[model samples]
Target: MFRSRTKDGQAVTKVTEAEPQQIRDPQAPKGRPTPKRSDALAQRRTLAKPPANRKEAAKRAREARRADMQRQRQALAGGDERYLPARDQGPVRRYARDFVDAKWSVAEFFLPIAVLILILSIVPSPQFKNIAFVMWIGVIATIVIDSFAMSFRLKKGLAERFPDENRRGAVFYAFMRTLQMRRMRLPKPQVARGERP
Candidate 1:
C-alpha cells in the first residue's frame, strides 16, 4: 500500500494487486503412467532394422499368419462363424450357406465327374475321347442351368426373408458355396440334406 493524494488533498492508502490463481481443468489424466523408451522400443519388434532382422520379422509374420489360418480352418470345420473370413461373416452369408448346404447341387459333382472325364479323354481310343468331351460339355451345361435356378430361388428367398438387408453378392456367394463339396465347404453345413433353410 502507498500513500496517495485525494481530490480533497488528503493522504490515502491503496491495496497492492493479488497474484492470479491457476484454474484446474475438469478432465482426468490417463490411468496409466508414461511408458519408458526402452519398453516401448522392445514392444515394436517389426520396426525396420538390418537385412537379417527383416528376414526374421517376415518369418515371424508368416508364423503368425499360419497359426491364424489354422485357427480359421478349425472354426470353419466346426461351423463357428466368429473366426470366419469376412466373405463368410454375416447373417445373409449364413443363410445362403444353409440354403446351399440343404440341397444337393450338380456343381458339387462337377469335380469328380470332371476328373473321370479327364481320364477318359486321355485314353488311346478316339471313341472314348469323343464320349468324354461330350460328357464334359453336358456336365458343364447342367451345372450352369442348376446354378441359375439356385440363384433365382436364393434371390427370391432373400427378398422374402430380408427385405431390408443387403443382398448384394449373396447369390454369387451361395452359388459358389453350392459348387464346393459339402465336406470341403468353409463354415461347414449346419443343416443336413432335406432340412429347410
Candidate 2:
C-alpha cells in the first residue's frame, strides 16, 4: 500500500526495494571471513625466525658490548653528557634542562634592550639619564653580539642533539624558547616557579 509519483507526475505503484547486483567478473576471488587474532599471531610467530648464524650472533654480542661501554662512559661523565634527561625526576630539574635545550631568536636578544630603554626613559632623574644613555648603548651592543652568538650556538646544539640535522625542529624550538625566555627565568629560580625563592 505504498504510493509513489511517476515521472509524468501521476500516481504510480511503489517499489519496496531494488534487487542485489551479481558480480560479472568470473576472475574475481570470492570474499572470505577475516582470520582470528590468535590465528594471525600464530602465523606471524611461525614466519618470525629462520635460524641465527654464528656471525649474526657475534655481531649482536659486539653491539651489546659497545652499548654497555657507552653507558659506563656516560655514567663516569657525571650524567651531563646526555642532552635529554629521563622523566620522573623533580619538576625544577626538568624545567632547567628544557630551558637549556631551548633555542633563542633575534627578537629575544632585543627584548631586554627594549625593556631597559623603556625603563630608563620613564625614570625622571638627570643623573639617571646619563647612566641610562650609557646603559642603553651597552644593551644595544650586547643584543648584536648575542644575536650572532645564539645563531651559532643553536646550529651546533641541534647538530649535537639530533642524529639527523633537523633544522626545522631546531628553529621552531629556538623561536619558542626565545618567546618564553626560559633561560632568563632560571637565575631567579623563584620567579620560574611563580614565587620568590
Which numbered prediction scores highest in TM-score against the true structure? 1
List RMSD in Å for every model shown: 13.4, 21.0
Runs in model 1 lying further than 4 Å from the true structure: 1-67
For each candidate, the alpha-carbon lDDT, in order, equals: 0.87, 0.53
Considering only N, C-alpha and C atoms within 3 Å, which residue pairs clash in candidate 1? none
Candidate 1 C-alpha lDDT tens digits along 58-83: 88789779989997998788867778
TM-score of each: 0.66, 0.32
* lDDT (tens digit, per residue) of candidate 2 on 1-197: 46788789999866556744466797676555579999899768745863378887677678768877676555434333342233212333333334333433345556676687778778898777788788778766765676557657555655565545324444444434454454453222223333221
Candidate 1: deviation at residue 188, Å? 1.2
Q: What's the lDDT for residue 67 in model 2?
A: 77
